[model samples]
Target: MDFKELLKELKGNLLSLMGSKFDELKDESKKDVQAFLNASKEKLERWTTLLAEGNITVSDYKWLVESQKDLVVLKGLYAAGVSKIKLGHLKNSILDTVIETAIGFVKPNKDDDNEATV
Candidate 1:
């Protein structure tokens, strides 16, 4: 896929994942998660705009990819930590699936069907 197609697909996938899976969070944590989703979406928008404006260099794309990889790591850690701390308030499996979905967008595998884990 072209860079623009990839970016649009990734953004749509992420927003969908957040919408479907974020409801698994506790009432108190919902706002925090929503805010995070909003911020991430905005960042994606900025990146898209930069690419569309021909302002993005190869180095910038490389940095963006690396940052996304870093985000996957952070998501893994957050899932683990929050799953433990929240106990019954959240479901780790759902969050894990969401993380996997997001990661797939960053480093897509044509073999995977993008199924959510139970």
Candidate 2:
């Protein structure tokens, strides 16, 4: 695929991941949710700055996608590690469903060819 297609896929994947993560937070205890929100806001600020600076190369984008996946796995592990934690299984499953839906929306359509080519 071309760069634009790759970017679309990446955006879709990121959105799906973020949506699921948000859904999971929604079912968390108020204190846990608040802490996660604070952390997410900080991380989002950094991501936005990086995006605005146009500092990411293709390799960097690849690394970012992989890192996000790793983070998801880490979160699952961390949740599992807790001895007496009340996990939100239903919310977590719904988050997984959201990711699947997001992935389904990533394909490019024919109308994308409207731009003038060099």
Candidate 3:
């Protein structure tokens, strides 16, 4: 598949995963999770469209990756924020893992680097 298609597929998968994770939260945490999911969905849509339209440069991809990383961090913070209200260690663990996995997707791969540090 082409880069745009790959990015689109990735975005879809991430959204699906985020939705599933949000569903696992208790009612009290649902609102925050929903908000996060909505924001993430919007960002993913924008990035995917830009990629598909060939409007994304290498720098844009880098920015996308960074933005995704920030989102993953936000997810983690949201999980922590709701940990008290959620009232379950298992749920907390699941949320943590989901955030970690999401972060992993956009993280820079060691093999993808071409620069040598001075």
Candidate 4:
């Protein structure tokens, strides 16, 4: 078609496309993002608790179960260790170590770095 006709056709298509219904998708996506953000916030709060309070609360039990699945002995150690400590008495150094360990930090092997020792 001529340039004028083509422009009119394109404009009409654009308008029709923009007008199509997507209310449900918008609402669903909003809910999904909101839920994701809320969950993230809760996780941050849990981590904060871990830092501020060495003793684990019930809310953290699920996370311990899920994240420590492969490290049964370690999980047991944490469970036992926390049990003996009163609430809010967790040492800052211990919390730092836990956070570091959870993020995959490990001590250098003695063979690799002789200067580093237990």
Top-scoring candidate (TM-score): 3
How many residue pairs clash in each candidate at the backbone level?
Answer: 0, 0, 0, 1
User: Ten residues in a row with the worst lDDT in model 3?
Assistant: 109-118
- Model 4, runs deviating above 4 Å: 1-34, 39-44, 57-118
lDDT of 2: 0.36
Rank order (by lDDT, best first): 3, 1, 2, 4
Stretches off by above 4 angstroms in model 1 are 1-8, 11-37, 68-70, 73-118
CA RMSD (A), model 1: 9.3
lDDT of 1 by residue, 4-26 (tens): 56545544554454455554544
The most accurate candidate by lDDT is: 3
Off by over 4 Å in 3: 1-34, 73-118
Error of 4 at 32 (Å): 2.4
- Global lDDT scores for all candidate models: 0.44, 0.36, 0.44, 0.33
- Model 3 C-alpha RMSD vs. true structure (Å) is 8.4
C-alpha TM-scores of all predictions:
0.32, 0.29, 0.34, 0.19
Measured with C-alpha atoms, the lDDT of residue 111 in candidate 4 is 43
